[model samples]
Each structure stands twice: as structure tokens, then as C-alpha cells.
Target: MKEKLLTKEDLAEDHKKAVRGNTKTTREDWLAEAQRVLIEEGVDRVKVDRLANKLNVTRGGFYWFFKNRQDLLDILLANWKDSKNDPLTHTLKGKNKTPLDPLVRFIFTTIRERSYSPALDSAMRDWARTSNKTRRAVDLVDNRRISVLAKVYQGLGYEEEEAFIRARIQYFHQVGYYAMGVHESHEQRLHYLPIYFKQLTGFDLPKEALQGFMEE
Candidate 1:
């Protein structure tokens, strides 16, 4: 008896089915899964073998999609930024059910909404000591977020420099709160929202309506 070999056409068909199932995946699928894995398990577990285990595939399977682990991590970093602002991100160039308001409530809502992206960002930052690419991507995401908040400050009638300063302070506060152990009902973060925002921007976010404070 002779060993049989698969034709290119047969392999392609198998890959097509794999792509649809997210079991065996394409490069983009690997990127998305890498990002998701990092957010859930951190970088140490984002290795090819582990991802294969997590996805119930084989280690050889990842090489089919990514050049290497570093390449996968890089993709995760890039995707993290896109995930941050795509839904209920604090930054706004367009409309959202909730735009910027009391810094505290808005920050909590964002945490609740975009939980994975921020967790991935934190995981990447912690691992940056070992990876240059991760460090640079983290720096870029932080700066872009600052820029977005600065724009929001300007809309609220602050001078550019003042807006920039307020945005900086607000960012720092939110980072702390995100990592803190503050439990609240849906009403809790919202109820205390004014206190935190007043402390940061010298204005409390009105709970009922945002005051459209920036509306002319």
C-alpha cells in the first residue's frame, strides 16, 4: 500500500470549512482570537500552543495562520486600539447613546462595555518590559486617547491648554478607578458620578441629562 497525499484543492476545501467554524482559522481569525485570548488570559498564555489548546486545535495549526508568536501579539496590540473606540468608547467624533458626561459614570460604563479591550491593554503594558513592539503600541493608544479627550474638553468651552490639562487629569483618574475595588449597582456608579467628575473637571455630570453643556 502507498501513502496518499492531499491535493491543493482538497486542502483549500478543508481550510474553507475551518474558516467558517473558527476552529481552524485564517490569519485574521488568529489575530482576533489572539486579542481575545490576551484579554482573557494575558500574554503568558497567548502562546501558539496554548491558543491551540484553547481553540481545541494543534500547535501546528497556528503556524498555518501566523508567522510567529510575535506576529500574533503585534496583531493583538493593534486590534486592542480598534476595539476600544468602536462601541461605547469614551472618545467621540460621532454620536453614541452616551457621550462624555460625569467622568466617573462614563468611565464605569466604558469599563462595563469595553471590558476586553482595556484588559488587553493592561496585559500588554505589563508585558512591554519584554517586547518593544508592545511598548510602542501601548504608547500610541494612550496618546490617541488623550487627544480624543482633549477634543471633548474643547467642545465643553475650555481653552486648548486647559482642555489638555483636564483631559490629562481625567485620564489618570479613570485609570485608577478602573483598577480599584469599587462595587456599585447600576445606580451606584451613576449616583456617585457627580462627585468624581466635579473633583476632576470642576463640574458634576448631571445624572438625568448631560446638560448638553457643550451645546452652543
Candidate 2:
């Protein structure tokens, strides 16, 4: 007997169901899984087959969204780069805010609360040790992030040299904290936060704001 062949419509339906079924394997899902694997098990574990197995889907689903593993890596690098220009930038550059307001908001929203990925941060920095492309991407993000923080300091009326120094201090401290794997308890850190803020910004974080942070 002649075998039945699937038409274009039938194949399209299968594709749709493949995406919407238990797997829901889309481009973002692949990238997110790659990031998770990169963070948890280093970049070596972020393979297409590994992610396909993790997602309970076929490697063909990966190719449906990515040309290859390198393509996924490129997307991951782009995401890390874009993270530098996050909502904190808008808070820093907004109107009607005190100089300290921007500083406090940037610290509370970005660093303390961790608006970006520390695991991916460490992973990318580690990846940078070998790959020139990864190094350049990491450097670009670092420069832009520090530049924004410096501008916030400059807006606070600090001299150019002072602003730059303060920016590096704030930015590098968080990087080092994650890079070195510091183990301070959250409550202890919160208790010391006002002191750190005073030194970092040369002023106190208001009682009300500190209270609000604890509430969060």
C-alpha cells in the first residue's frame, strides 16, 4: 500500500504543537537555558544537546531557533551587553530627584537588589579569560556601567576626579563581592548598609528610605 504523506498544513500544525506542548521550546527558552547552564556548570555545559535534554525536546527544536551553539552564545553576549542599559539608567537620569536620590535609587535598585545576574556576570568574566570576543563584550559593558554611575556622581557636584573614583569604587566593589564569593548574611548587610552608603556617597540614606528598603 502507498504511504500517506503529510501536507504543509499538517507539518505546520506539528510545529505549532511542538512549540506549545510540554516543551514550549522557543529562542528565548534556549537562551535562558544556556545562561542557566553557563552559570551553573560553566560555559562548557551550555551545549545544544544538553539544553535539549534539559527542556525535554529534540535538538531540532534548538536549530529551529538557533543556527548553532555559537549563535546562542552571541545572543547571550548581546543580552549581557544590553543589561547595562537597564531601568536603573532611567532612574539615574530622571528629573526632580536629588543627587542623593539618584545615588540611593541606583544603589538600592541596581546593586543591593541585584538587577543583573551575578552568576552570569562571573561566568562571562570567566569566559573572558579565554575568548577575546567575550573579553571585549565584558569590557564594553563594564565601561558603560561605570560611565553611567560616574555621571550620577558628577551630577551630585563632585569634581571630575572624585566622581570617577567614586564610580569605580561603587562598581568594582559589587564585582569583587560576586567575583570573590563573599558570604555576608542579608540581615547583617542590611544593618551595615547605611554605613556603606554614607561612605560610598558621603551622606546618609534617610531613615524613611532605609525603613522602606527593609520592608522590601
Candidate 3:
């Protein structure tokens, strides 16, 4: 997943189709499953026949929703980026969140949840190195999200560059933690998430940062 190889026109068109679901199929649900596959399995693993089998639907059923595998991926990335990010935006708008602390929570909470697939994370890391188109898309997606994050951080007094750099480092931190998280239990891994996140960004990540969210 991670915004691997795709064209802008292709992404826009696919985004439209997913957003405009008709009665012939449940476009959102199908796209949700596709996103799960991409996030959990990698962009290349979004096989039409396999998805068809997994959904207990026919290949024809999938075709009704997507023109092909590429189309499915385009929609999946668009939707995931759109949906998974709403909560972060909400936190940004609310007065309750602390400077940079919400950002750390967004990063480490994803690690705690295993939101992205290990298989897919590896694929995209390699893909970004070799595929020009994919690297560009990755850059766009990464920068686009970071830019929004930068805005939030700047409001808290970080200069623009500082905010972006913080977002970038924290982004990589979440990805790295996800790739290596299998070694620990959920509670154990989450225990150090706040401090580890702060270290990545060279920021004053709040001590007892997550105290309110945890139960004794």
C-alpha cells in the first residue's frame, strides 16, 4: 500500500468511483476490504481473484466494483488516506491535545493497533527505493500528510521546517516500530511508545504523556 505506483489521473478517477458507490455493489465495503489487504498484505498482494475468493464473491463481482487490480489499489490508497486521518484532524481542532503529544499518540497508537501490515510495509519500503512512480507517490502521500501535520505543529510554535521534520521522523518511527513489533506483547510495546516517539523527533515528548488514557 503506502501509496505505491500510480498515476494522478488514475488515482483521481478511482477515487471518484469509490466515492460514488451505486446499488450494484457496496463500493465502500469492498474498498475497505481492499484497503485492509493493502495495509496488511502490501500493494502488490491486492489480487483480484484472491479478493474475490476471500469475499466469497465472484471475480465478476469484483470487476463490477473495480476495473482491475490497479484500479482497486488506487481507490484503496485514496480511501485509507482519507479515512484513517480524520481522527488526527479532529485532535488538531480540539483544545484538549498538547503540542506534539497528539502527534506522538497518532504515531504510537498506530503501532499499538498494528494498523498497517508488516508484509505491505516491507514491500513499499523496497518499492520506494526502486520504482520512480511509486517513490513519487510515496513522496506525495508522505509530504501531503506531513504538511497537514506541520500546520498543526506550527500552531504550537515549531517553525515550519521543524514541524515537517518532526512529522517526517515520527512517520518513520511508526513504520519502523510496526516492522519490528512482533517481539513484544501489546502492553509491553506500548509502554515505551511515548518516550521512543520523542527520541525520534528530538522533541520534549511529554512525560506521563499518555497517563490519562491508561488504566492502572
Candidate 4:
């Protein structure tokens, strides 16, 4: 029998299969898996071999992207800090074209969309209990969040003292809800959102904005 050569189409199809079988994992993939482990199993469980096994890939995949385990952990911490602060800063820096704009944006973005991670937040707080470095990171995130929230209230015509207090009330309420594992569905919480906003700011959030949250 004569030797046979593959056609271009056959070669291309083989290449596709090879690529599909060995999917390229990025730094985000490793970080995401590590974060999941950190949240579920705590920081001690975020080791490279452990994560690699969980991700169903060899440790080489992790080493290729990270200098070492500490480097990967540092990146994860940085991501947590950004995830905590950025969205709050963005949402609170509102033009407030309407009386309810800032409050509505803050509620919608922070509460409903929940752009940050509660599990990660709780995990980080637990980690902070032992590590001063982690504690400082948590402090920075908390201070920035509360300060920005205070500024939002100040913008809503609250005095500096009242603004800070109201900010604490709102922020602490949220932290307590997460800490206590209180679960309220959107439907259950819907009627109370505007009421909470009003009590927090001493001003009614517009009916339209209230409706927006209810509809969700």
C-alpha cells in the first residue's frame, strides 16, 4: 500500500480538536479557581497543587502564569481590593440628575447586581483575623467604602456628621446582613427598599427608581 497524505481540511480539523482538548487557561482562570477555593475552603486551601487538581490541570499551567504561589496570592488579593472599591467609587460618583439618582444607582449596582463577592468578603475578613497584612487590606477597603458612601450622603444635602452616621447605618446594615447570613429574596425585600432608602437619606427616592428595583 502507498503512503497517504492528509488533506488541508483534515489537518485543520485535527488542529481544532487538539486545541479544544487542551484549552488555553489564562491568569483569570487560575485566579477564579483559587478565589473559589479561598471562599469555600479558606486561604489555607488555596495551594497550587490543590487548585491545579481542582481545576483538572497540571501545576505547570499555574506556574506558567504565576512566578510562584505568593505571587498568585498577591494578585488575588489585589483583585479583591479592586472589586470591593471600584464599583462603589463609580456608582457614588454620580451626577445625581434626579433626587434619587445616587441612591438608586448605589442600591441597584451594589445590592442587586452585587458586583463584589460576599463569600470572598467573608473569607477575607476571616483571613484578616490572623494576618496583619490581610487585616490592613480589609481596613483599606472598609474605610474607602464608608468614606465614599458618606460623600454620597453629603451630596444629598446631609451635614457632615449626619452623612457619616447615615453612611455607617447603611453600610453596617449590609455588612451585618452578610455576616449573619440573612437571606431575603428580591420579591420579599422589594417593598422595603424604598423605605430603607428614605430612612437612610431622610428623602424619598423617586417613584420611578423605586419601581425599577421592584420590577427586578
Best candidate according to TM-score = 2
Tens-place lDDT digits, model 4, residues 1-216 = 221344556545543443224686667788999888888999888887787677666565565577778798888888777744467667777587865576678777756657656777899998899778889988988888889888888877889999999988988887787899877887667767778877877888788877766687
lDDT tens per residue, model 3, 66-87 = 7677787766545434535444
Q: lDDT score of model 1?
A: 0.62
Rank ordering of all candidates by TM-score, starting from the highest: 2, 4, 1, 3
TM-score per candidate: 0.71, 0.85, 0.63, 0.83
Residue pairs in collision within model 4:
none
Evaluated with lDDT, which candidate comes out highest?
Answer: 2
What's the CA RMSD for each of the models?
A: 6.7, 5.7, 8.3, 9.1
RMSD of 2: 5.7
Winner on lDDT between 2 and 4 is 2
Candidate 1 per-residue lDDT over residues 1-216, each given as its tens digit: 222344556545544545335354667666767777776777777777566566655455465565678777666666665635443244344454543443434455464554324465567777776778778776777677777777777877899999999888887676665557356675576556567677877765665543332231
- In model 1, what lDDT does residue 174 have? 64
Which scores higher on TM-score, 2 or 4? 2
The lDDT values for all models are 0.62, 0.76, 0.60, 0.75
Query: How high a TM-score does candidate 4 get?
Result: 0.83
What lDDT tens digits, residue by residue, belong to model 2 across residues 77-114?
Answer: 88777754455555566664466777777667645656
